[model samples]
Target: MAGHDMLRSISRTFKLPEELFSGMPRIEINGDEEVTVENHKGILMYEDEQIQINGGNAVVQIRGRGLRLCTMTRTILTIRGYITGVEFLR
Candidate 1:
């Protein structure tokens, strides 16, 4: 089997989510106040009104007011503020 296919098979056998092995970004939003992104590549832009994240397959765009970074790690980040919109651009 192909390398990727093999990895996928292994992941399934272990009951692991595919995103963990696929490098895809996972996003979670809470109400209109916060957003958490996992497996993100990096931050492309940051501001009080907007932020851009480098997702593996797409660019994550966040627009808001009073935006601030609440937490950040190598693969995960949390944004807090009055979130107005979220978009994924390919």
Candidate 2:
């Protein structure tokens, strides 16, 4: 029974998404890691290596690496990165 429990734990570990360990934001990372923004209208300001995010009413999805958000406002978001894919689900 103990072995079974251990196996279950191990299996659960694999179930975790790769992004979770990579510090991948559940929302989005701005300026290619320069900043981080949440999905709920949150903004992040990045200068040097520090990151800041402001909360509001917006959703961001980040996938892959390197993102630069030049400007973001209500209903409009500007970003630059090696964008692989982007979609608006609303």
Top candidate on lDDT is 1
Can you list the residue pairs that collide in candidate 1?
A: none
- TM per candidate: 0.80, 0.29
Model 2, 1-90: lDDT tens digits are 455455556656888643333322344434443333333345445432222443322223433345566676653445555554433322
lDDT of 1 by residue, 1-90 (tens): 366567778888999997787666889999999999999999999999999999977799999999999999998999999999999987
Scored by TM-score, the top model is 1
- Residue 58 error for model 1, in Å? 0.7
- Alpha carbon lDDT of residue 31, candidate 1? 99
Ten contiguous residues minimizing lDDT sum, candidate 2: 49-58
Once superposed on the true structure, which residue ranges of model 1 sit more than 4 Å away at CA? 1-16
